[model samples]
Target: MRAPRPRAILAVLGVLLLTACGTAGATDGAERATEERVVRVAAAADLKFALEEVADLVAEEHPDVRLDLTYGSSGTFVQQITNGAPFDLYLSADRGYAEQLVDAGLAAPEDLFSYAVGRLVLWTPDGSALDPAPGLTVLAPEDAGTVAIANPEHAPYGRAAVAALRAAGLEEQVRPRLVLGENVAQAAEFVRSGNAQAGVVALSLVLADPLRGHGRWVEVPVDSYPRLDQGGVVLSGAADLGAARAVREVLLGAGGTEVLERYGFSLPGS
Candidate 1:
């Protein structure tokens, strides 16, 4: 075969280089475009419904970003995170637990902040079940068979329940009748499920549709316990730190704040 002219060989090489560059660029763009980020969020059980609402709202705007939420007592969630549960964010029902994560260096302390102040409520489905007039006074020590409370050892709501009972002068009376739950949501379930005649639960849970349809409740006096300052933090090992940050903004944003309020949660400023 005759050797190709220098100009012909140079032109062919140039064409090959251009084609390779185009293909590489397309591949790079495809890889970048195909990458979708997911953020795992660990939330308190009391926030199950509220967080679900916010998740739905965020999903409308961020199709590529997803929220993977796990709900439980704050203590349990914190323990999970410390054990490397791969959560990107943590929302605790109490500021103390969130601070514990910050102190343990499991979370980014700078990102730690309180979102809401939880309220405990005394709820009952039957208005006339034991009342002179439907109130906390009726579930007195002599009257309660089973009064549900979150586990005070781990659940912030449980701690509040203890405090509320103590303040109302019903602790001793209700003590023997107390039935513990793992978290505030479950505490509400005890009362709603009729496992316990009445219970102390987070106001948010009692206000949820299922509970609302099932009963009526009184907001436990704020004077009873230290404020249930619910807080959140961004985890250090999150894959999409930016997305996590976006989620924080949305949660603290007006829309999220509004949802929290309607669910009986008190906001930071309020």
Candidate 2:
């Protein structure tokens, strides 16, 4: 065509720009829809290893969903959730904390369910002279200077540790040499780092590889401590309730149970 007017050329360019913008908008929307759907999970430190395996299973099944796990003492998570933390799910080492969340209106009471039963173990780093035993008597040796345990005030594992010690009549003796950790994982870390001679930690932790080989452990008597009936709740403020529920279901299902059992956890109500 004969040379188009400058105005006509400018108009054509504007139309092209508008078309490009529309295409970009549609692409952006599609990308947003496909972006990984993240579900924040606040889990007890004891679930560190097992939960990770469960998360991997979840990822394999639901490629669109991503689990973001935050591990800590269940009591700490309860406080955070009660104070309005943005978590999609809360997996507590103790069922009491989950019930507390339900009672406080932070979670649906019906959504609370027991997932696993945790067991405590006396863990000593590999090559340590200390012998693993059912009771705290192993720590009586002068060389076993200090014992690490989670904080009893806020950690379920810590409370269990204290209970076990009390039942074994060693609470009085061990109390003076106790080095407290913020959570069970940290308590294990204390022993691993040689800051303590031994630690009372979750059996799940000691069963996982790397850690399993890193230390020697003995199961504490079940009667020595109260049952660790672990439970989980979907938070009332969940960003994706469906996804949260799906993850919970996966954990309660066969595949998840297999992973939990592999990590030394017992299924609840089993």
Enumerate clash totals for all models, in the order shown.
1, 0
Clashing pairs in 1: 141-173
Residue lDDT tens for model 2, 1-270: 899999999999999999999999999999998998889999999898888889998998888989999999899888888888889999999999999988988888789999899999998887788888645788765667889999999999999999999988788888999999999999998998899889999898888775878878889988889999999999889998999998998899899999999998888876
Minimal lDDT window, size 10, model 2? 133-142
Candidate 2 positional error at 183, Å = 0.4
lDDT (Cα atoms) of all candidates against the true structure: 0.84, 0.90
Assess candidate 1 and give its lDDT: 0.84
For every model shown, what is its TM-score relative to the native structure?
0.86, 0.95
Which candidate ranks first by TM-score, i.e. highest?
Answer: 2
Q: Quick one: best lDDT, which candidate? A: 2
